[model samples]
Target: MTNSKDLAREIVEGTGTEVEKGRGPSQASQITALARERYELFMSEDGRPYGVKVDGANIALPLRGKAGLRSQLARIYTDAHDGSVPAQSALTDAMVVLEGVAQAADPRQPHVRVARGDGVLVVDLGDADGQCIVIGPDGWRREQRSPVLFRRSGAMKPLPLPLRDGDGLAKLRALLNTDEDGFRLLVAWLVAAFIPDLPHPVLTFRGEQGTGKSYSAKMVIGLVDPSGAPKRTAPRDIKSWATQAFNSWALCLDNVSIIPDWLSDALCRAVTGDGIVDRALYTDDDVVVLEFRRVLAMTTIDAGALAGDLAERLLTIELHTIPDRARREEAELDAAYSDAHAGILASLFDLLADVLRVLPDVQLTERPRMADFARVLAAVDKVKGWDTLESYKATARDAVADVLDGEPFAQAVVALVDRAGPGGIVLTASELLERVPAPDRLPKKWPKDPTRAGGQLKRLAPALRTIGIDVDDSKRGPKPKKQRLYHLTASADRRCETASPASPYDPETDSDQQEEGGRYRGDASGPPATRGDAGNARGDAALFVASPQDTGPDQHGYSRGDAGDAGDAEMHPLSVPAPRTHRTPGQDAEDAPQDARPTTPCARCSRAQWNAEGSPLCLDCRTAA
Candidate 1:
């Protein structure tokens, strides 16, 4: 018996001889020659080959054969790229061979067996216009070209929070607690900070030194994304960095002293959704629109000097001194707390992934300020049990106060006006005393003097202007003749009216009198009179005295008591021979009473006259007295 190797060699040799010898033989030989030629052509490619016997329609491939024979048979079975054969038939044959090979490979390797099919060997040119062949169990196949480029789809990984331990985060939470409005403000800040599409998001932690303002800011960084948070820097450096970074990122500026107004405005605009800065990236030559989405958490000892615009956008967190020893002791337990929450934090990432999965579809419709606030709430809500995020809505409202119409100066002007009262409307040198009590108390000579008080009022005008109150020249004059008077325009009055009644100067009927002296007085008896003339006094007194119906007895002393008596009194005049009054050389008779002995002519009347009514008081005196 011969071994399988010898048999394989014998078969391969016989097939080769028959194929060459019958190449151009006679009819009977021609038939055999055609058959052999066809067989040889079938096995013409590299790699394994298998022999298939075709008896009309029944096709059969050799399962067991010599090594060379089997190799040739495999190649014949897999010749899908051969041009001599019909394209469809060649692909069909190649697919069978590929399938067999796939079955022979180790089962451990991951493989999917494609079903046998026509044209399985065709290469897929993807979305581009091109052509090639890929052999598999299926025959050659062609893929349709795509018109546009394909892009991979997936969510972006969230920025990692820098804090590693629960303790650090807890401390941050505690620090934030110092500011009653911190949580909401911080959340809004983080939203603005992290959202690249939003503009300047400025979070200002303002308080006295050593109030943990810096610490509070750091805590916010830990809660947001730790990796992207930048260290505190000077205002100039912060401005430079903000202008350079293409994307939004958080910046904790610790211990900022005086931020330039321009920088503050820029930062405010950036955070409040309107900020845009010119930016040139390393990869790009031209400057492009660079916007900040980063939350700007700044720690400042003095916030008074902060830019008005910037200050308006900021969510101010005022830190107070920490006093509780127990709280301090808890703060000391940061390490243990972090260890406890490590697993929970890891789980939070999974939760965050879910949130990202849905966040893209959530519409943001808040106004710029409110939108910033909402974004923060959304971020915090992702953390379990942070439902209190709603509180930030109020903070959002408060932060926008400066930008709203007539906001900054509303209270100040109202207070100034209320203090000023009706007197404030017609401003005079004396009216300053009512508006500013202390200034008014300064010696009357001080603020009242045109050379002194005028300058002071001029200086104060700007401060008043800050609240939208204006001083104009009195309608009574021009230039040097112009006396300054404050007028509340209709617009200004509306502002004051709409403002909260809690305003420092909200007017009330029972309100305490602002000045020591009343604004108006009808009676000269009240105090030493300061204004009006004698004519006015006489008219005022007549109106006062005539109002009483029971005062008829008081009228009896008048000369015009009755028409009948008036004529008789005029004819005789002296009820008992008008008593003559005497006077010494130096004394005038007018100084003597009518009852006194007559001396000389009455000085007032220039008449030697006397009356029971003591009318030596001449016409002017009689009427006046």
Candidate 2:
């Protein structure tokens, strides 16, 4: 008799010849056909990974772990044949053939029990009946089965059956320990979570100890994705964090006390559309990708000063501690929430569908860091006749900061420039350090030496400019300009220190307290060519921005001025300035003429004082001369 190997090889190599030969169907064909009959295999939504659709189910089984698809197939064979399982050799041969089936399949974008389908929002109920809800311009209603393939994780729990008339939203809202503006933001975040393809903002809540931060987070997560584990402690590292991301649609870190550098970077990536990559196993070259644009939320008492990138992406909402008279037992709150859960979900769906109907007509003059999030919610605000976006912008604009509260280097730079007056100071890293040494209680991120100081300045230049401090690296000129120098001045609104164009802000005497931002937008009204890259650089400078490494010592870092050592600060800023023609760092009078760039005006020529109407002369110090 022929061995199973001979039959398997024949099956794989066969053409129409097998049928023409009119022989009995081979054992290999029978084994492979069982999988074909029981499952439908195809690529995932992004067209990079594969998943299996179990014959009569709404959920798609992932082709992830070593036995992800194989185990199910083994169970199927046993159940089909009177508790007699297939031989291990036969099962192995079948899986190899099934792999071929998967390779030849088409790509289908799988939804995580929530997706947009046929001009409506599709949310799988995750129930045993395979039911789902279709929400759109017409309204929301239940369907026998979801039209989209819902990718369910092992940890995913079913959503509450939505009640069209329930006051669930009001109940949930009353439970939140926030003000009206905060409530509006909370609702907006919930709506944005359901929308597809947009970059979602991180909905962060912080307050005193008894503010119900974790409880609020749990309630919010329940609205979209109700899981047995609603709130998780922040993961220790990026790898563990990525694992948490794969297991749920909504990721909530409860009462996080610290936002470490690695976690901060990862959260930013997740907020936007960046992927989380990890080793498939400890001993292999294989990888896993959780690249989906997911909904992110966090609760923190004080993560301390947030990183600039994180600040831009954060929709920070403050919660107040529950008054002793108002506080209720956890069991009471849970029982009431359970009663109202379905209605709240229904009301949210109703609002989202209405917003979707008018979403195309909504226009935002200013788009923030999470522009997509703004666009969708702006549409909601337009329909509701509310200024929810205005509230979001106000919060975001205030939070988009370069310097964390109490940062030594930035505070020192502010002081140094304040002392020198408007012209600012032109000096090297060491000189600047010598004159304006960091305070005794140096922050952890402060630079220890000149090398670190220069690096810190390079990173802080864009952020510093937000508060009206300009830093520039001057090019070597004639003999007088022997040392490469860094030119510091009160921001251009205050002086004619560097050769970049007039900044995009009020061209007048600014207030003493320079605000971090006036708007949460780039120049959306400006032409794309003129605006350049939509980077994190605050204000007009971001319109034409690049990465800090792209800027290097040549543009704004510590150059080897007068043969000094390199000094850089520890933490890089959230944004770097765009490349521009700066006054060749401390270029003397003649050097500017040779480069075809205008020379720096005399010390008296700055924004601090008015110049003579028709006179080329500017300095009040020189007016007497």
TM-score of each: 0.38, 0.71
lDDT of 2 at 9: 62
Considering every candidate listed, which one attains the maximal TM-score? Answer: 2
Q: Residue 289 of model 2: what lDDT?
A: 68
lDDT of each: 0.40, 0.66
Stretches of model 2 off by over 4 angstroms after superposition:
1-31, 45-51, 66-68, 85-93, 279-286, 398-403, 415-435, 449-455, 458-625
Per-residue lDDT of candidate 2, residues 420-536 (tens digit):
444465667776677676667877887888878888788767556655677887643238646556777775554332222222223244222111222111222233334332222
Q: Candidate 1's residue-wise lDDT over 41-111, tens digit each?
A: 13211122223233221111222233322344334534632522323333333334433543453321100
Global Cα RMSD, each model: 27.9, 16.4
Over 4 Å off in model 1, which ranges?
1-181, 184-201, 237-239, 243-248, 273-289, 323-416, 420-625
